[model samples]
Target chain A: MAAKNGSEAAEEHTSSAEIRSFFDSAPPLKNSLEITDKLKEFLDKNSLSAGDGRANRIVCVTSGGTTVPLEQRCVRYIDNFASGHRGAASTEYFLKAGYVVIFLYRRGTCQPYCRSLPADPFLECFEFIDESHIKVREPHSEAVKMAISDHQNVVEKGQLLKLPFTTIFEYLQMLQMVATSLRGLGPHAMFYLAAAVSDFYVPWKSMAEHKIQSGSGPLDMSLVQVPKMLAVLRKEWAPFAYCISFKLETDKNILLKKADMALSKYKMHVVVANELSTRNEEVVVVTGDEKVSVCRDKTQVGCDVEDPLIKLLVEKHAIHIVDSCS
Target chain B: MAAKNGSEAAEEHTSSAEIRSFFDSAPPLKNSLEITDKLKEFLDKNSLSAGDGRANRIVCVTSGGTTVPLEQRCVRYIDNFASGHRGAASTEYFLKAGYVVIFLYRRGTCQPYCRSLPADPFLECFEFIDESHIKVREPHSEAVKMAISDHQNVVEKGQLLKLPFTTIFEYLQMLQMVATSLRGLGPHAMFYLAAAVSDFYVPWKSMAEHKIQSGSGPLDMSLVQVPKMLAVLRKEWAPFAYCISFKLETDKNILLKKADMALSKYKMHVVVANELSTRNEEVVVVTGDEKVSVCRDKTQVGCDVEDPLIKLLVEKHAIHIVDSCS
Candidate 1:
């Protein structure tokens, strides 16, 4: 049986050669496979699989910010300063340490370093400013007209980024769906709420079915709270996921106090504190226990802080960590 | 004075040689300075202040799914299959266009490509799922669980791809604020409504500030139409900004009828249409005036449809277009 056929040996030789050539060429598809294989190998070499009962080490990370929709006519949205560098870097450390991570990221936040966008939706950029005529004031009319003319020249010559939005309510509805889905994954998970969720949503009253003449009634848009999503998360979904609240304060005492209060109110396991006004690179990680305090070095301005945080989490949990520091 | 200056020059020369030698032997700081200069040069060459307004083109990119929050937990939160790819990719395109793009994103959507989370402020990614281990059971439970679990694992493993959001209300709030800011710029602006903004919002019974516990006397969440925002934009902010709305339909009659309705109601210059089930690279661009109908190459998976859309907008407007095509 061992010496059955020369053809079998020949086929095996050809297969090995093909594999070698494919690896040598390093196609993108092949590269992905190689990376996947490496990860699998790492997971396998050490008992990182859920079957090994290590899957219980789950961490859910929510990064980026939220939008508040006040009305169908006008909305109020603020981009959180979350670059996702901290979350991404930290998660890498968590995975390396054999923990499962669930990332709840806001749209338009950070993506994988190598992830590329699709290539068909030919996008268009434009500036829609219309300056056909300018109102003539008495003394400053000539100067104002000249400035307007000059500005028109620039507008006619340049392109403007066109972004489309219809109503604030529409935007908010979408976030609730994502949050609801996240709430379903059951407990044994940890939520790293790093995204900047907006505080206000606008409400439109008596919105027009057609474009109102430019100068219509005082056209006031009303705003309201973003339906207290954090509160909802605490009450409804908190039981299924470990919650971690963050307080970015310009004042030191307020930061610590808020963190402490959050710990009590939300029953968070860990609370991280830092100064929003200062540009220094130091962070204090506060756990629910109050006794666990860890300080990490300030990351470089453009560097990702995710890795360090992950390291800290892994160290605290005593989980098997991956050695890929990169 | 000449003698004293000559002595001073001699002393300076000695230190200058030391500095030059240090740069030659260890050029990290020097390299950083060089890179900074390059960035400044690029900015100067593209900024309006630098005489070249190539980089001033603005792309108002939106991200994240919409959310509809309820005062109490609801049977339905109003949602869709949007992963926020449309908005996120558009944002990246706007940034690449050398335009000062203001991203009007939703909560719980994917984040923009280049954002930074500081360590000092203690940014954390948390989920409410791991709190008390609430189990999920519903018709949408399996799908929702899978979505959340996948995101959770990726985030926990330190992966870069993460989707953020839970409902549509938050998404709308984010868009409204951005729209107001862009509208303030007055015309010369472009808006792209690629996000799947919901047509309905959750109706609440009351705004009581009390915990809504499970088994609380047959709770109910009502649904109501979300007032059309496109109409509001045209009436309140038109001539300041041109609008584009997306119409995803399963039938051609509905698509055309809705397109016409949107055009007449919102006074939108363009309406992008796609089949409700259409995914991947396939899409249809429908203009309000029938000026042009363009078909693009099949969209590559994971890429963006924004490029073609941006191109069309620029061509039709006869304005300069900025992009990172490569």
Candidate 2:
């Protein structure tokens, strides 16, 4: 008998018609499923390799950016732009595919999607100031107040961590330290260098001693180039890590050219090229040998193209796919 | 015939000795006033200097801390604890001293402060947030609708500038870059390393390539120590910049010791040590050579210390104080 919820099941199905036709023409679907299950179990127990001694199925990902302090006394600080939305999403998709992920990131960005998170010690929920406004008071604001109170109260009881920095130099030093550590993870690591690094930085000799006047005159300071950090990934740190770079461009032609350049220069496996426009969603995933361009009908609200990108990644790497990198 | 007010003044003068003493002290008071005016002008022209040509009168400020991303794609991050209050205060105090301040910070932390900032671009008014968040409507709930809306509106119209960062690595990188830039400013630059830097960072080898299964297991990853950023400050970058390290200790006794350690280790001119027990006010300034502690009667009601610590810094460094540092 046909399944009662046949349409619902059909909607859940993801295989292409060609694959379905092959299954229908060859062996029964149930038999193929059983074989796959048996194969997975066997592989799990024996650790079978696909005709090679070298394990060729590893992906490394780097998330988050560096931080900077303004001075040695641990006061003011600076940093570049990045939020981790793309990095986190890609991490989730990669994890779902049963591939080992090497995640390198800054400390403050979002924790991995499903990791055990430290209870927000300072989750003091504030109440509404009015009906439209939430004031920091009783039952309504208890949660936020509780959180902040938890953070503060515990400190009052003498337990708190206060880490401070004053300038950008300290921040980069920290990142370099972390990167050097990440290098130890060895090859088969896929470094998704999605961190938005700064292009220009304050030159210390010119800026360190200068008194910034209140009513400013013509203020000028010379800028110097920070050593190209991504280059370090390719050369000194994480040599074996499969490096992937991002090319954010305003023009389409320039983007493709830049992606090609990145692939050639950095030996990147994939380059995610995004157009820098207002609420733009289309992206091109440039591989070493081919380019996969995705155009989303962003006209519909909440139609995130990130999902399709995930699907493409999975399909390209799935064992069933002929071009599965793994 | 003296003024009618003189009648009241004469009635208050009960003693002949008091009248004689007032006349005697008047000449000296007038001299002292002249001296103060001369000192103020001289101080205005020449900033307080460290013996070695550095700006002895300097304060380092920092704001923001580790922000945890809420989403997987590297967007929508969260912070453990940061409102940038302390940083803003430090900047204000430094400005009052008639010193030049080269601010290096991201945008999101400074958005609210920008609205209140008296306009100027050189070193004032900088807002730091993710570039993406610059336009998009944040997930709106009624609680902070007003704040979120105001922040977003200011951001979209370019009223504020954002220096974005997604990861700790990038943030650190930018920091290093900017620190070097400031290093060029010569010995007068004083460094305050006070931004809340994250101590633990994710190792690259631990991230999963695909999403982990829903069923819970002992999900664990190795977190490595980020290098001692301050040590790096003393080592490579800004060797000449006057360094003031911050020591935030929960214990009063430890505060001085930690500050002492920072001073010795970094060879800093001063250390701003504080007890985190009280937020409104509780901090000490520990110059490598001396310790100036501000002890407030926390138990006393209505006893407000209008920046006792800052007042001390001003007295010590302001050229007007005849024998302040002495």
How do the residues B113-222 of candidate 1 rate in per-residue lDDT, one tens digit apiece?
32222111001111112322222223333333333443233333322222233445444434444455445444445677777765544333332222222221212222
* lDDT, candidate 2, A99-218, per-residue tens: 444344554454333122222211122222443543332442333332233333332332221122222343344334434544543443345566555333334433332212111111
What local lDDT does model 1 show for residue B281? 48
Candidate 2 stretches greater than 4 Å from native? A1-60, A64-78, A99-103, A106-187, A202-216, A251-253, A278-280, A295-303, A314-326, B1-83, B87-326
Worst 10 residues of 1 chain A by lDDT: A119-128
lDDT of 2 at A184: 41
lDDT of each: 0.42, 0.43
**DockQ for each numbered candidate:** 0.02, 0.02
User: What ranges in model 1 sit over 4 Å off?
Assistant: A1-326, B1-55, B72-80, B96-98, B112-177, B202-205, B216-218, B250-253, B291-296, B299-304, B319-326
